[model samples]
Target chain A: MTDLPRPSAPPVSAPTPGGSNLDVLKHQFQQIWQVLAALALIYMVFFVLSEPFRSFDTLLSIFGQAAILAILACGTTVVLISGGLDLSVGSIFAVVGVIVGIVLAEYRLPVPVAVLIGLAAGALMGALNGTIQVLTKVPAFIVTLGGLTAYKGIAEILASGRDLSRFPENFQVLGSGYLVPMGIMFGVALLTGLFLTKTRLGNHAFAIGGNEEVARLSGVNVRKSRIYYYMIGGVLAATAAILEVSKLNFAMPARGQSYELFAIAAVVIGGTSLFGGRGGVGKTLIGMLIMQTIIVGLSYLGVGTSVQRIAIGIIIILAVYWDVWRRPAR
Target chain B: MTQADTATPLLRARGITKHYGAVVALDAVDLDLHAGEVLGVVGDNGAGKSTLIKALTGAISKTAGTVEMDGKDIQITTPTEAKAAGIETVYQDLALVNELSITKNMYLGREIVRDTLFGHLFGTLDFAKMDTEIRALFQKLDIRITDIYREAEAFSGGQRQAVALAKTVMFGKRIAILDEPTAALGVRESKMAMDLVRSLKDHGLSVIMITHNMQHVMNYCDRVMVLRLGRLAAVRDVADVDGDTLVGLITGAAEDKVA
Candidate 1:
């Protein structure tokens, strides 16, 4: 770029005050291609490792299993972009499952009514987390850490340490039916993408995450925006729980344990920044698929569950490392 | 009628004072921002220039003051109210989010939306409209960008300042307050930024620029206000004084030249 505007240079000449258009295209492609390439590599390896993985049924089943985690990761993407974490999602997930199971089995409510109650319960838990974080001026990490333990305790008490199971066959459609959970995941993802890109609240979340002080000066209600993202995180956790419980035909107090870690791993692998601001649910979906593929691929290769976990842990670390290393030139 | 009654100032402040516990940041500062004029605020460190800007922008509360717009008293308790009241500030920090695209940063707090079938179900951004609007705005300012979709971090310091000015023009139609618009630029880039500031005036927007650059004040500002030790030392039309006189007033070494 020329330091000084030449006397002869047309006032609004050709390209950028920064770099050439080609340079921008190259930078843009680098971010998109890295994840695409990784996904392709994972698929290539898995295709060779197992014949069943190539089957259409297995592909659908993989997505079906990924549905719950992918939905949870969508919420995580929102929170992370808004510069917060939701460690309480797993505990919230467990509690939602327990609440839904009780409403359906004990209260004998209709599935729709029970589902709404469960979602509301999840929203309440999220509101609690957000309210405390905002009002008390506490960090989200600390607030949600407390929530992780406290919510699990609530789930345990609700279930009285006994697993709840055996819902109506109609209720099973939500979980056992491949289309429903997958449909929910896709619907949630689509909505999330729009929210992040189009809405004023979505823009506020990015502003808050990017620089809270700046956002405040720009007339963004930073505190309210933060609370909203947390609420969304809560509601999504509940949705994931509802699906998981329906699929298993059981709701245990311990269900969704360490599920927070899995969701976070998917978000990071999808290249969302842990430091907050700068990512989307689209990349997060890719991240979720990559995570699931690894787990499934390892199992097909006869690897033990423990080894598969170790592999996942390593990938998460590497993914984060690569993100930090490969963050576009500031 | 008083001499000042012939034409009402666009905005007026009287007896504005602010104290931070023990320290008095601003002391009975009175000023007028007239329509279609550049008012340059010059001061040394802690001269209460920033404090005064914060007060005017409603970023903070004043200990005692009255602000009048069109002869009507108004209370601006927050930045949002300040914005709604047609006041915009381009802070020294520029206040751009590095992670967001130029378009996103431009419309950070205020986003435009359109109703679509899915939008009725879940709201969507009217990105096409925003893109066209921003592109036209940049073209008007003579700022070239390879891609508006590029993040703010990808731009140079000069380019970012241009983008910030575009945002100010978009939001602050009545008045623009720039806190050091040319502080860190090279000579040519400073010229570019100054030209953008000049364009704001040409478009008939009132400007209040705070800077240490005497040349900039002399060249760009229509009137200059000097603050010293939390007090208004001098306010003069740029045509009446030289750069040295302005500096002397800022340092409290020269007698009040204007009065």
Candidate 2:
């Protein structure tokens, strides 16, 4: 039987007059120009106000400190874009750190094995969060909010109220230098960006967030895809936790406390929508850098920690306001 | 255009029923969609119009029914299964992600990836290929948009409708189901949308459209099916029925003459 030809593969014709190379560049710049301008303006303000902030070393250290948050925020960016939240990420980080500490300090496992186990634990916790939310049809906010407290308790129980320290020399090297954590941050960011833009699941995340019922009608497995997003968030949280523990050579149950909020703040500051379906890891990187710059710069100017917190709080509000204000009325 | 095909319909649904507890939404509704023809489904509010379409397209499960394609029984309990059975639905909401580019929304669930190791392992989308093909499709369909890379939110309601229609044309094989394709558009936009609906037949695909617009039914549909109070009321060639008769059939003022 001769079947009708499917238009699945249309003949490739000449490129359209619009969307030229320059147009593409212009469009790309349009998406990021506002955030980029904000970052530059903030940096310049800091550079001019504080003499110490003008130095290259201070800038390197600011990025070095921002690296951990950047890694954690990458996962947050994915989760937010998928229209879900994982408030337990901070606890997930602490739990993974404690797991790594136990595996190395108490169990005498190899670094690679312990690292794998920690990562797995992180994924497992994330899976638990995602699975519980899916099965119960509970809002992710309530589920992860409960997990925020519960997972922290679990981590504390695992640590027995003591901080684990003094890791092997090679393990300490993983986070000791500026390059290693920064490299991991960029690598995770690159991977996260690719996952969002390149892969089918990544695209589904955006669709699901933008309008879940529509995504479902379009044959997207909303439940399954959401779980995968939470898993990515979980694994990245673990990555950040391990790096922090290695750098500090200590793992306390209190580690990564309130880091989830910081990650979210950074993601929002980077122009990612808290409501989801609109943001990228690249914007998130800039957001993280902007945040770190403000914190570090304020300290250089002899501003107290309380004042620094106020500054971050104000920035977060402004960022979200800017997002809402600029958005065309639907 | 009103001449019925005596040959087998491309898609047929029998005894499609749905119940919400004591409420009977659709009751034993039957439909036949012939090849290369537009079938308009019309009903008043709560007259089982959307429910019948939902049952046929597997958006909602039927209480009792069977759907057939090409004279063969097919099981479709979900939208994915419906699409797999050569049925695509353009939902009332259009289902376009506001933040994504037109090309991205066009290939949301079924994205084309690079045929490389990266594609195999990581499922990296080949945007260049997608861009090229979508442009070709728009050109072929005579739909013009300056940039396919613009987000869906940036487009007007009519443009988004066009994108949704284009998507159905792209992936829909034998049958395309549209749920209120122009319910949201202005007068001019609605005309454009109906024009696209008419064009769906030119592409050699059968269409089942759900609409309340009498003008659309008169202009676009080859045949019209009326649903009233959870049951199939009448099926008429658009050539035979006036707009008043369709409204009467929907409101139960006039009995189904053919029945």
lDDT, model 1 = 0.85
Q: Which pairs, if any, clash in model 1?
A: A198-B125
Model 1 regions lying over 4 Å from their true place: A1-14, A17-30, A49-58, A161-163, A177-179, A328-330, B1-7, B115-123, B255-259
DockQ of each: 0.42, 0.32
The interface RMSD value for candidate 2 stands at 11.3
Candidate 2: tens digits of C-alpha lDDT, residues A229-330: 999999999999999999999998888999999999999999998888889999999999999999999999999999999999999999999889987555
- TM-score against native, each model: 0.90, 0.93
In model 2, what are the clashing residue pairs, if there are any? none
- Highest DockQ against the true fold, candidate: 1
Q: For model 1, how does the per-residue alpha-carbon lDDT over A1-330 read when each residue is reduced to its tens digit?
A: 112222433233346643445765686677667787899899899999898788887778778889999998899899999999999999999999999999888888999998999989988998889889999988989999999999999999999955488998899988786789999999999989878877878877777787787888888888888888988999999999999999999998799999899999999999888888778898898899898888888888899999998999999999899878866533
Backbone clashes in candidate 1 total 1
